[model samples]
Target: MSMANLSFLNVLKLDNNQFTGQIPLDLRRLDRIKEFSVTNNRLTGQVPALKKGSVSVDSYAGNLGLCGYPLPLCEGSTKKARTGVIIGAALGSAAIVALVVGGGMMFVMRKVVRKKKEDPDENKWARSIKGTKKIKEG
Candidate 1:
């Protein structure tokens, strides 16, 4: 019952089905496939490189896992995507840390400035007693 056994099939449309797993390589043997499609299926892995121009790019639509020609390149074929994600996460974390530290520094600085302003005579009493000497009582 393999699809290869149907060598005479000229048009095969298996779209919008619940089919899973890779598209059988045997289907490539169908030299007479003039119109083919497996869109909106759960098919995974690369689509067989059947006769060029025999299948449209839309034929693989909705198959997120399917790749190769007529579809997006597979995950292995692109490293920038993962690298970009990692870099983006790192930058986001760094930004958050900087904001927290900056906020803390600003709070502390404001408190110190406010204390100085509120106590303009702060240490004036200590300065007045700086030259005072302790006297022994008879």
Candidate 2:
């Protein structure tokens, strides 16, 4: 039988069990619940909000996939987290691209500068010779 049908239940403890799947949201309908515990279970999915102080972190312990208030916010907690990750990855990629292009340009410029320094007058002499016409040796 479902626990939600037990509307008159005041205290429910199902700790240290092999229960799997989500804790039913209908459990919140048990208005008479004064104490609830589902710790040490294989429960997954967000834990439903029950009585104000009836549930705590300890009540949902050992369930790694469970989340929501009274525990950490559920994974992906809407699109904000996913969007942030996407934006972060995009910015990281852009930075990498910028670094690669900048490094390539710097390397090319350095090579040109070194070549000029090594043969400062090589091109100058060639240009001067081209400008002068050869005289006949008769």
Candidate 3:
């Protein structure tokens, strides 16, 4: 990423990777970053003060060697992290439900497709739809 041409990055989705060291200082310069994340990695050091609602605690986990505000000043980082986990879990559960419902809907549509393929009457009607004769009134 050339520092010369990254002025409009609204979302920095760097989750679930192996990036080490502290959060890059240069990132603070990007005011357009609304969804910054560096979760499930080995990143250490203080958590940066992200623009409110722009970043969440979920974006700073799986690393057993990091602390600071948002992660919970120092004394309560562990407790706060637990809460974040519960929240993440709830969100995760909702996502799973959505996927299941979507999958079921797709499955039902596939069955409908198969039934249509099995029914010759439906096929013939659909095939002749554009060729049907228009009746004239006397």
Each prediction's total of clashing residue pairs, residues at least 3 apart in sequence or on different chains, is 0, 0, 0
- Candidate 1 on 1-138: residue-level lDDT in tens? 898788778888998997999998777787777888998989998788776346878888888889978787777756877888999999999999999999999999999999888666787577667788889899
Query: 62-126, model 2: which lDDT tens digit per residue?
Result: 88889898898876677788899999999999999999999999999999999889778767667
What TM-score does prediction 3 earn? 0.46
Best by TM-score: 2
lDDT of candidate 2 vs native?
Answer: 0.85
Query: In model 3, which runs have C-alpha deviations exceeding 4 angstroms?
Result: 1-5, 74-138
Q: Candidate 3: global Cα-lDDT?
A: 0.75
Compose the digit string of candidate 3's lDDT tens values, residues 1-138: 853146677777778888888876566667666777787889887776754345767777787667776676665667889999999999999999999999999999999998878774676566657777889999
Cα lDDT computed for each candidate against the true fold: 0.84, 0.85, 0.75
Ten residues in sequence with the least summed lDDT for candidate 3: 47-56
* Global fold similarity of model 2 (TM-score): 0.54
Question: What's each prediction's TM-score?
Answer: 0.51, 0.54, 0.46
- Clashing residue pairs for model 1: none
